[model samples]
Target: MTTMPAPRRLLTIAVLLALTGLVATGCVRFPAPESPPPTATAGPPVLPGVQVDVPVEPLPSSEACNATLTLRPPAQMPLPRQMPPNSTMAGILERGRLIVGLDIGSNLFSFRDPITGDIQGFDVDIAHEIAGAIFGDDRRVEFQVLSSAQRIDALRDMTVDVVIKTMSITCDRLRDISFSAPYYVASQRILSFRNSNVTGPAQLADKRVCAARGTTSIGRIQAIQPRATIVSTTTWADCLVLMQQGQIDAATTDDAILAGLAAQDPWLRVVGPSLGEEFYGVGIPKGQDDMIRFVNGVLERIRATGRWQEIRDRWLSILDSGYGAPQPYYRD
Candidate 1:
């Protein structure tokens, strides 16, 4: 290779560098320097519109119609395959399956089994009993996943024959749907990090507590602890994630649900006294007197025959929840 003198080599390098700069500015434009990629230093995940300015929804008056008083069951309940002609049970039988609305994420109540992919829980068994009463086979039930807000609408639009989600019986809900006699009575409570020192409502002051929107828990918590800031989540699991991420201080819902959340993470715990009773029922369409009576019959039978106790023991006992089946109440 021929070697150039130092001055000549330096001049050649300068000319090449100048030519490269001119080419970059005049030809390809170098992609306009990339503009830093529209990035942000994110701290935690959150759903949009989750924060809320607590509204004044005073708790529904306790006197708002005996919330648990549902239509009384028939004196002579019909056997499977013997549904009355043109009745709700007959229609369900004709369809060959009972369509149920529930949440798959509601662990211990109706979550999918990790091994088998089947949904089984306390509420699920109650629904199974209804299917057995109508079709002579408990397996003759189809579950449709739904959110808490969609339960009533599902029944109203005939999208589901029943909603076995952990729904509460309240006067406000009673106006929209007829409930089967109270099957499980839950109480609103709080869930927080085990070491968070948030043991009860007293510690909730100024804390951003989360609950699912369109749930009775919101009004109950708001009414009980006006000092705490409340945020709305679309689902209970969202509240759990928010707490896990340290985005929220605590979560409030029925003890049954809080138990499920606590079971998922060892670092979480359920705390506080019951805010109030929340009676869960098999939500039926309003004006479906026969269906309401029939479902109430199923609930009554299960409560008396020890089946309800079996379900309670199987799913909730592991959570240290020894709750008994809620007693039935009849409007008649």
Candidate 2:
């Protein structure tokens, strides 16, 4: 080999050593970490351009039940007003109309008259009572059919003066609106095909349950059976129709509502112990203390004069003697 300068030879040896060290150290890059595989228990999985929040535990019916179970109002609860001290009642009278938001699909609470095409039920009677108190005639009231999701928004937007759609009183709802004393007490129940093997909430695991969207029943079902699939419909009647068609394994809702459905279809039956109690109340826009008090007064008078009992008997006798008994709501 030809002789090289000492400095050039040393530089060449240094470059070769550096290259050897890099190779020995394994500096070559490797691949990135792999993402977790999709899981079956994962709820409503994420896909392209979509996101979902995990469903919450089913709400306890007991929360609403305990809130209204007592005859006395909470210490922090506001006292009922005697009457509107000014012209509010007079203004309602001048309008000659008492508009109320109600559920026409809920059988005993509010439903259509097959012959006259008019609304009728215990809730409808309550609306009529309020109208009669404001005007001298109960027939002055006009009914607007509302879905569960539409009830609160309709009241807030003044689309209706009040909501008597078998609405349950709850702290979450109190943040948005005021409620009258509970006019009816109901318990939550599960409905299934007449021969379903599912006995209770414990048995609902992996089952497909149906409920009306925006109703408390959906929350209750999810809470009890986190793994169960839920199918939501716009109305309880629609849920029942789906159940009849064998599209869903079960439906969860108030006992009164299930009772109505069972009455209509012998192929279905309600099962399990009552999930929880619920108290139905009228919803009004918050801060309308005068209107709330006026309603309380009307409710009190009706309870005292046997009119409330008569209305309940006329509509709810199908629920049995236990339901026929008078259970007066708390009124100042």
Candidate 3:
């Protein structure tokens, strides 16, 4: 969605041009040898390469949407490697692997294990469950890392069979893609340094707030505090880096994701009341209803077998006990 109005977009570009001229002319310079190039934004300080999304398709609204609902699971799950003929799972079986899309920078949801050089997290475990269901071997899945902005397009293009990222299901997104039953319910919140005066949403006026580009979080901030400067990054991890460097006042996103960011830095903490709830679900390509039902079947199995709790305890135990696996709901 367009992050800024037309007038503001032009002004920002002009400001950037003017700043480049100043740096080129040696009229002004950063105090340190390695500082981010000057940004034209009046809201938050942005690092080089971190960006502001120009106007695009207006973000879709979640009005009259119950993101928690998804296609019902099959009456009986087929044995692994025994996908129903002509079903989406059967196609995946023919391909010999399940392809998944997710970002590795999302900490507890998904991230690389520096020690093992492999991706692992709550989401990874869930992805494995789906793959294992189809191939009888979780490793039969091919993992593809994606930025937040790329999740839907990746699914639409069939680059991945499904996306197990920290994606929230919404009515607008459903227009282009399908989602599995809600697996996790997250709340939108803010993350700021512990000692910062910007303790909550009320204090966000004119302060620079950072969130991943093209996410619902950015739009919420834009509506909550019109004066707050919203900086868009490619991922929430980028927001964490900018916050650590004092480049931005605060970062906003789902609380579960924020908790991951907080664990990396002692100074960071989730603050203020939650903006709203985010219902996490698997992303499947639009019209892939069989795949949707199959993924829902896997999720249902996980929840019933207590594996859902196991994954949560393994990866998200650090979050306050209030957050837990969401109950599944079906559209049919």
Candidate 4:
């Protein structure tokens, strides 16, 4: 090698040393420039292109029974066509029309006729039968469209005489209102898209489920799948709407109601086993034992004479052809 100046030789040695040091280290490593922690999104989860907020209501207290429990009506109801004097029936008759509180959107239980513009369904038929007994005609009644949350209040405010919506008879509700004998028995069930892999409530983990706000179905859904995101709406119709929009993973309520929704849409189907027992009873104002008795009597007549079966055949035959009226359970 040719001789070099002292300063040049020192610079060359320094550069070689630096290169050797770099080679000693296997590869230049950095502490994975710390990734920014994931940020959470604001507001409740919203469906793409939808403005509605999937409101989450507080889960009912555990003191609320999770079991399938129902109140038993009197053991024996008055015979059909027999109304006690000064009873609720008298007041309703005096009013000229039985002001019945119900939602007109329930597909199977109560829905409006497209051509006739008359409300009709299983629940509507039940109300009509009661009206017929009082006035010999079912049409002598006024149908007040009440949301699910408004049913009890309407009865308490005396705005409506009775609620024939798909009201479930529950222990908590019993404290605030009276109910006739269980006219129809339906279990809490899941209604989901036909293509969904979820077979039942258990599969609802991490899923979004919709139920009518202020109804028993919401509580039951929480009990069955605490991990599920419950979206409580104002009506079962709303639940159906959300499901149709793909905003919810499922709609949960009485199988009867689910059957109604499923009937309207072939893509939707009711799945899952009975999460809890649901007793469909007519909701009456508190301290209205006379009304309870009168309504129970009407229920007995329908169940006895096969009119209940007829209504089921008419409105719910699509779900179960062999369906029969639920036997009344009387506590007294």
lDDT of each: 0.85, 0.74, 0.85, 0.77
Give residue 79's error in model 3 in angstroms: 0.6
Model 3: lDDT of residue 62: 48
Clashes per model (N, Cα, C within 3 A): 0, 1, 0, 2
Model 2, TM vs. native:
0.74
lDDT against true structure, model 4? 0.77
- The runs of at least 3 residues in candidate 4 whose Cα sits more than 4 Å from the true structure, single-residue gaps closed, are 1-85, 320-323
Please state the error at residue 261 of candidate 4 in Å: 1.2
- How would you encode candidate 4's per-residue C-alpha lDDT over 1-332 as one tens digit per residue? 98999999999999998888887885555566678886986644443323233444444331365312334434565443455568777777777889999998788788888999878888998988889877776789898999888988898888988999988777677767777877887777899899999899788999988877678887767766888987877777777778877778998888888888888788998887878767777888888777777677777778888888888877777764233677765555
Residue-wise lDDT of candidate 2 within 1-332, one digit each (tens)? Answer: 99999999999999999889888998756799999987756333222211122256448443643444323323332222222346445556667788899887787788887899888887899998888777667899878888888888888887888899878877677667778777777878888887889878887888878776667877777776787788776677777777776667888888888888787798888888887767788888777666766776677778778898898778777764334323544534
Deviation of model 3 at 324, angstroms: 2.9
Residue-level lDDT of model 3, residues 1-332, one tens digit each, is 84898999999999999999999999995586787888775755556557653233344344477666678888998999899999999999999988999998899999998999999998999999999999999999889999888999998999999998989878888888888888888888899888998878889897888888757887777777767887788888899888877878998888889999999999989988878888888999888888988888888888888999999999888787446668876769
- Give the per-residue Cα lDDT of candidate 2 at 173: 73
Query: Relative to the unseen true structure, what is the C-alpha lDDT of residue 313 in candidate 1, on a scale of 0 to 100?
Result: 82
Better of 1 and 4 by TM-score: 1
| Candidate 4 least-lDDT 10 residues | 61-70
> Would you list the clashing residue pairs of candidate 4?
73-330, 73-331
Q: What is the lDDT of residue 67 in candidate 1?
A: 80
Our model 2 lands, by Cα RMSD against the true structure, at 16.9
